[model samples]
Target: MKKIIITVVVILIFAIIAIYCKFILGLASQMANPKVSTLEKEMSWEKEHKLWGDYDDYEKEDYIVKGLNDYDLHVTLVKNPIPSDKYVIISHGFKSNRYGAVKYVDSYIDLGFNCIIYDMRDHGENAKATVSLGQFESEDLYKLIEDTYNRYGNIKLGLHGESMGAATSLMLLAKKPKVDFVVADCGFDNLYDLIHTSYSVAKVGFVLPSVNTAMKLRYGYDMKKTSPKDALVGNEVPVCFIHGEADTFILPENSQVNKAATEGYSELHLVPNAAHAQSREVLGKAEYRGIIGDFLNNIDFK
Candidate 1:
């Protein structure tokens, strides 16, 4: 009887250890190697250059900024045809590069705002190996915002991001960078919640709890503490959130909840038949341009 009890206890301990190891490995792989879908590859601007004629006509200056942990981030500063102090920092989504932000540049430029599009760590030319999701990326954004202020001096700033980029922008609110407004497109509310929803009940039972712990142990960042929901709550900045009603990847509900958390200062726009980051295209050129233009016009920039 004693031997049987000891054997059962040992088996349970080994099972727990095995579960922890598997969870940690899976979480690490997800963060390190984000897979880009075939549809997303086809969505690149290089493949659709004709859609944005004269995109090459604009002059872009290459800039480098240092992140919180000394990670060097590459940036392309796209000055408007006519110089203006009004600027917008464009952040692209997960598993994407600065080109992912190219589509939105025209709208801001049309509004007479200069654009700063940067590659988040691990996604573009940056040397970082691990994706912090939005943890360190948010800090990188804050640094870029600060660098913009220090370089340009007293400029009206706005932030715009898509998907993970949007979540990073939302997280940036906690840093309290001096800015005019924010535009978040198809952003998730919380990192853990997003991951949790993406997995099955069986996976979540073991994997969800160790995700943050593994992140902290291996990557040295706490995943649970970083979220757009935490940043947007009671945030005084006027924010405009756009999401595709047809999006199931992150779901449009994330935006709805985030908009609700903004306490009446934010505007939410839902585009029909669009799936994640396809709002501008699905809304058609004229309507999309009008909606963005109106939002920018309403902001009382300094």
Candidate 2:
């Protein structure tokens, strides 16, 4: 029995080591070679759906923002014709671009808010294809907010981000609490939980340490730093978290976690019979718009 116990312990140690090595290799592979699929490429169903829009009338323009590595990051901006002091920065999710959020631009514009929609790194017109989730993308948001303030001059800023973008917005608040308000839709509370969800969706066993290790190696950031839970805690900014009750991608609990993290000031709206980013589609535009309008009316942007 003693020998059997010793063997079991030895096997567990070896398994753990093997998993760590696999994650490290995965991270190295991602960093050594970043790959972005072509905007025209339809690699998967999700990719195809994400690319199914034309922003011809959106009138896209480019802006170069200075980055930490002296990289003049390029951002595509879509401006509303009717401008106002209130402005919103919309961030798209993983494997998606500005077009994905264009549908909601009018909602903000109708409220007399000018919208600035931009593509994240390794996405859209950006010259890379590696997604660090919100690990590095959060910096993009910070830079954009700063640029907006410089150009527009101390305007009331609002944020709308979906999935990975939502996570990025939360991380941005943790790093810098400048935005007046935030709307996070279907954002995962924890990076570690997100990785586990991905694995579960693929019918794989949970390897929490492996996912955490991979994130650390790829982004040079730990899970704690990337956690929306930590970011939302004690945040002064009022956040409205919108999640579909039927969402399986990030799960509604993730939004609840964010709400709990932010005290009672943060609001969570769970749309019934909706599924991930489909709240508007499921509830119809009028109802969806009304919900957001009510939230905005309740908040004091001053």
After superposition, candidate 2 runs with Cα above 4 Å error: 1-60, 200-203
lDDT of 2 by residue, 36-108 (tens): 4443442243334442223445555777775434444556566666656888888887766665666566566
Model 2 residue pairs with clashes: 36-129, 122-128
Candidate 1 displacement at residue 16 in angstroms: 8.4
Question: Which pairs clash (backbone N, Cα, C closer than 3 Å) in model 1?
Answer: none
Alpha-carbon error at 194 in model 1, in Å?
A: 0.9
Task: Candidate 2: count the clashes.
Answer: 2
Residue 205's lDDT within candidate 2 is: 36
Error of 1 at 246 (Å): 0.5
Clash statistics: count for each candidate: 0, 2
